[model samples]
Target: MPESTYPRTALQRGGVPVPPLALGSWNTWDRMSKDEAVALIRRATELDAGFFDIAYYNMGPHAENSRTDILFGEALRASGVDRDGITLCGKLWLWDWPNQGFRQQLVESLGRAGLERFDTVVVGDYGKVPDMPRLVAEVNALISEGLVDSWGINNWQIAHTTQALDEAETQGVVAPVVAQLKYGIARRSMAEGEAYGALFDAGVLTLQASDVFEGGILATGRQPERKVGADVGGIREQIAAIYPEVARVAAGFGVTPAALGIAFCLSNPATANVLFGASRLAQLEQNHAALELALAHGPEVRAALAGCWVDRDVRADGVW
Candidate 1:
């Protein structure tokens, strides 16, 4: 395996340092055994990729009241990894916001994971437009209360995210430092498009690239068995239609489609971290090649992928 040459990025405003890659435990934890989970964590720490995106799934369509949080907590303790050496990024869903509230949600999530605090928490998807002032105030309160070091947004509307930045500024408090969005070779509009791109360019927000492989469809060149992200503007079929082109390009770079997808996200100047999931150690090791690919062939990778999904200019939507 190649050495990890990807440099750390200091997220805007919060100054939270993150590696170019993070391990996301979305549809991953429950599938692995305790030993597998412990080994994955140990290996991630050794590779300087200890950051984790964990959440208690109890909201939206994907919600199944999973105990993956508890499982991860057990694995962490059993792995004997140093707590201070890793970063934990949790999520607070907004499906029942104002009623459920950030405080209660954060407490429950922390309790479930047996963790003291999350290094950062992403304020997650909402059913409708949210009250920006209240949201900002609560997020700032969490920071002051030492519950979370920093916060970010997930799959929010362009205007809503901008309003969050403004509300934080008006309150004279810490603004959100990152925006996690569906960014990958198969989908590029929301993150790379004009709206969020401007925020990134202006240094008001950093990009946390998510769904980089389109739920493994882009990487495998086949439809996944499980449900994936919504097909906004009906772009999934179009993305599938172009898989051969994507594969050809990846082959030209002597990399897998997965590596190409991850490299595409890391090549962007605004990207703070790219979140990917691995159910096995081999998968985790293979994905790390993306950093080297990004370092050595970033420009060419970006240029090669620039023409893909050009028609996917739809707004960010769905139960993310």
Candidate 2:
């Protein structure tokens, strides 16, 4: 059976209403100049994409650059977006999820971003798989200290996230609500495969989906470099194979493939927020417009693109 698709408008993070689209700063460093990046941040704010996504990994050499939070801070300060108006979501490695290590990492991340608190902090991918009980304790402590509003996991396999949620429930701490994962036409394992479909069925709704463009696969104009963890060549082929169909469907609706892709995710009723990345104001505006168009044509596009999902051996290929 095909995975169920859902559509939802907003979700509350620390009492703030989050729109369905967010600004993702993954590997955005050096893609544009500082001034341009700041302007882009302001642009995102104007477009209601104020839920900014950042992580420590985005700052390290893996991206060949650094300090996404710092960049966002600069943009926020310059853009005049009130701290309370926009929400910041940060990611940490599992190794930092226990004891003082988690707290210290949060402190550093906050300091770098020039903020006292973030709306949500997630343990990005299970690196060494932190001790679940201790990890929950550390997360609860942060919430108690008011250092973070809500907490969750990102990029964790279904089994790990399921275990984390169960343990959090057993331990009587706030369970992780937002489980960030990759989901798009090019990366359909989590969305269509049973691995994460079960999670949605389990009542988890806040799925902050990133890479909706599939590392430049679905965009209309010149695509920026693909900057994510996946089989670049293989994904390119998958996108190539589907581009004609996506373009045809998009043209049929008088929208771009980018809009088709975003709409495809928006079609999923359970997805709370879909994250998109941009290094320029124009791109941000484009995606923001596409987001609204997606909402309008979400169901139709989902039906059209039903056969375009890259549902290869997900677990065997390690995409999960």
Using TM-score, give the best candidate's number: 1
Residue 119 lDDT (model 1) = 91
User: Model 1: clashing residue pairs?
Assistant: none
lDDT of 2 by residue, 1-320 (tens): 11112233434334445766687767674477778877776666666676788765532334343776677677677766677767788776664345437788788878887888878887766556568787888888888999987887777766677777888889888878786777776677765567677666566646777777767767753344555555533555656578778888888988767767777776776677888777777776666656666757777777888778765555622243
Tell me the deviation in Å of residue 261 in model 1.
Answer: 0.4
Clashes of each: 0, 5
Tens digits of per-residue lDDT for model 1 on 1-320?
A: 22446787877654757767888877788879999999999998766578899999898765779888888999999999888878899999889888989999999999999999999999988888888899999988999999998889988888888889889889999889899988888677788788888889999889999988877877888887875676656777788877888899989988888888988999999998999888888887878888889889899998888778644656543222
Q: What 10-residue stretch in candidate 1 is worst by lDDT? A: 311-320
**Deviating ranges (above 4 Å) for candidate 2:** 1-15, 58-65, 95-100, 220-226, 232-236, 316-320
